[model samples]
Target: MMRVLVTGAGGFVGKHLVSELKNRNYEVIAAASSSREDAAAGKLHGLDITDLAAVKAFIGRTRPDTIFHLAAQSNVMKAWHHPSAAVTVNTVGSLHLLQAIQEVCPGSRMINVGSGDEYGLAGKQGMPLSEETACQPQNPYAVSKFAAGQLVLQMAKKNNLQAIHVRAFNHFGPGQEEGFAVSDFSSQIASIEKGLLSPVIRVGDLSAQRDFTYISDIIAAYVALVETDVPNGVYNVCSSIPRMISTVLEHLVQMSDVDIRIETDVAKLRPSEVPIFVGASGLLEQVTGWKPKTVFLDGLERTLDWWRSRVGL
Candidate 1:
């Protein structure tokens, strides 16, 4: 079995990725950013990704054949408010991981997880965003991811490490952080169902469009990429289909049996937010013969059901 180390294993995507990895018979070494109890049972390593010494130590100790660098401060709004911390954790932390891989597991394949936000407003004209698209990151988080992605490519080319960068679009499902739009909407709806909150669902920028993929589909893509003999390059992991937030909200509202009022929250709106973000997974499909299978409406219903079950509805 192949041995893999997944950073940020406690995170939403990380946890799901680790689970998928283990299910595929890969020995997983899960590394979390904090000392919290791991969500999945594995060789857990609690070490901050931003710490260079700690990262190097873990890589040396684990000696994984593959490193999935998924740990980072990914919230755009949070990165906007705390740019320095975002840079430190996302960019600098990624550099530390690369350095560790170079020093310890010199021949390891590294999958540097990146974001679709790295495209910024370039894909707003309804064209499918591709790996060839030039990165014009607007937010601090996007900037950080772009920088780390660039660094990964540059270092991989220079040092001969099997490093590939993956730019994943908006993915949502259970265990997602509450700060994201999907989770927030689901949580609010769950609260309404539980009588913990009013029937009002506070939202922002419902007109914006996103290429949302279910977490399981996203995890399957990750697993496929790992299994495939994909060359060291950048590829997008996303649903080619993009839908407006209004459409998603409409479906969610329809799925809910209760009357829910929609109210716009001024605080939720961000200046210079990308109105539409979409990506094409053509390269991934060509290489791995995988495409996202979950429909947007179906995924939304599943998410709603998850929140409902969690809130005891």
Candidate 2:
């Protein structure tokens, strides 16, 4: 069994990934940045990636066959408010891990998880983005993730390390928080179902289009990259399907039992954003034979159900 270490194991995607890895009988060592974010992480190893010395010591001790780098300051609004912190965690933290991997276990492969948001304005131009797409990185989070991916590629080439970056698109499913569109809609519907909030569902600009993959499908894509002997480069993990937020909202609203009124919440709106972001996962599929398996509607329904369960409905 290949021993794999997953950073940010407490996060939404991390939790799902960890479960799948364990189910596959991999030797998994899970670590989180702190105790507060330890729900899915198990708090087994509070490995702070920002601390260089600590990161080095932890990697040296674990010495796993592969390291899945998932740690990041993922919230966009938080990134805008604390750009330096975002850079510290997303860029510098990744550097610490790469440096540690180089020194302690040069043979260990690392999968640096990045965001599709790295494309920024460029994503707004094309129908579907590919690996060759130029990254403009609109926000602090996107900029930091883009920098981290570049740094990883550069270091991997120079040191001959087995490292690759993945530009993962928007993924949602059960147990997701209210940051993204699917979860936001689902959570509100769930809240209304549980009688926690009014029948009004407040929302932001819902005209934007995005590439959304089910969380399980996203995990499968990452696992495919791990299992297959693919080349060292950036790959997109997406469904290659453009989904409008309004359509997603309509689906969730239809799922609800109560009569709901839509209300535009100015607080929920972004300062500025790309109108659309759809990625081509052909490279990922061609290499790993991993096409998206879950239908978007099924995934959306499951997400709403998960939210309903959470609220004890």
Best by lDDT: 2
> For residues 1-313, could you state the per-residue lDDT of candidate 2 as single tens digits?
8999999888898999888998899988888876554556454578989999999999899999999999899999999999999999999999999999999999999999999999889876857999998888889999999999999999999999999999999999987888888898898899888889899977778888888999999999988987999899999999899888888898889987799999889998873366778999889888889999998889999999999888853
Candidate 2: pairs in clash: none
Worst 10 residues of 1 by lDDT: 35-44
In model 1, what lDDT does residue 249 have? 77
Candidate 2 segments whose C-alpha is farther than 4 A from its true place:
35-43, 264-273
TM-score: model 1 vs. ground truth: 0.94
In terms of TM-score, the best-performing candidate is: 2
TM-score of each: 0.94, 0.95
lDDT of 2: 0.89
Q: List the residue pairs that clash in candidate 1.
A: none
